[model samples]
Target: MNRMAALRQYQKVNSQAQTAVATPHRLVQMLMEAGLDRIAQAKGAIGRKDVAAKGVLIGKTIEIVGGLREGLDMEKQADALARVDNLYVYMMKRLAEANIKTDPRILDEVSGLLTTVKEGWDAIGDQQPA
Candidate 1:
């Protein structure tokens, strides 16, 4: 192969290896960011005692969780992802209840749950995928 062709091939292989090395860390970061965003929105809505706003945030939270699940391979991370999914669903329900009753407690509960999930994700520390 010519020099240019060999350099291009080398770059391609390097790019693939980089992606392989980064995938798990990227996934964890994405999940953590989503969870943190949801928690922040929920907290803001609760602070304002806005039922409609809380409902909207809850809907977004559900979407984020669903997206996380879609990006993940269930066979590889089924247990952890399942648990996170369940917590997300539960948070949605709590948000709905808070909206109906304008209860700030529900928001606090969901925020705590999201915090726990974020901590768990941090603990994984870029390790190999489960």
Candidate 2:
């Protein structure tokens, strides 16, 4: 195998190992981090006028947000979680718009929203034993 391909394989294995041992809270944290990273990369792709990369990155970010939404406890329809679910839906819509327009402002808006959510999650993590 080539050096870069081997490195990617190693990183994938390492990430899987970390996920296996991570607590539930940490898993959510990691997901949020990944979503934010994808959004940032998508914004960069927009700056570079890389339409293909922007589409793929935004798509990944949408999937990450969707996963986070799916993970929410919605059976009881708790007010707070319901609001988060709504926010995720909104983020996905904006992501689609951004992809079509190649707009960085929309990306920035989504990034800020996700960062706010992540900050709240991190605060909760600090209070919980993990």
Candidate 3:
């Protein structure tokens, strides 16, 4: 097989394996980490003046944030879920603003906010019965 085909095969198999093993909590943790990673990379791309890369990374961050928002359980706790939804929306807007303005500080703000959210989520996971 060609190198490109081999890489695609590997990725497909790896993704399947990950999905087979992932619990809902693990998936949420993965999404949060991915979002934070993308925002950090976008910040670096901004510093390097790589406009295209910055835009792409920031776009991924926005999508990841939106996905997280969609994952929230609206029926569980209305107030808390609404707050998280609002935070996710704010993060998405800030990510777009950062991409448009090429601002690292805005990415920093988003990253910090995500980190706090992740911490809270993890704490809840810890308190839950296995």
Best by lDDT: 2
lDDT of 2 by residue, 1-130 (tens): 1223322322432334365556667777777788898899998998898999999989888877777777777766589778998999999999999999999999999999999999999999899863
For residues 49-107, write the lDDT of model 1, one tens digit per residue. Answer: 77677777666665554444444554666787677667656766776776667666776
lDDT of each: 0.57, 0.79, 0.77
Tens digit of lDDT per residue, candidate 3, span 1-130? 1223322322332233353355667667667777888888888898899999998888888877777776777888899789888998999999999988888999999999999999987897899898
Error of 1 at 87 (Å): 3.0
State model 3's lDDT: 0.77
Q: Which stretches of candidate 3 lie over 4 Å from their true place?
A: 1-17
Minimum summed lDDT over a 10-residue window in model 1 is located at 1-10
**Which residue ranges in model 2 land beyond 4 Å of their true spot?**
1-17
Q: Under the 3 Å rule for N, CA and C atoms, how many clashes does model 2 have?
A: 0
The order by descending lDDT is 2, 3, 1
Clashing pairs in 3: none
Is candidate 1 or 3 superior in lDDT?
3
Best by TM-score: 2
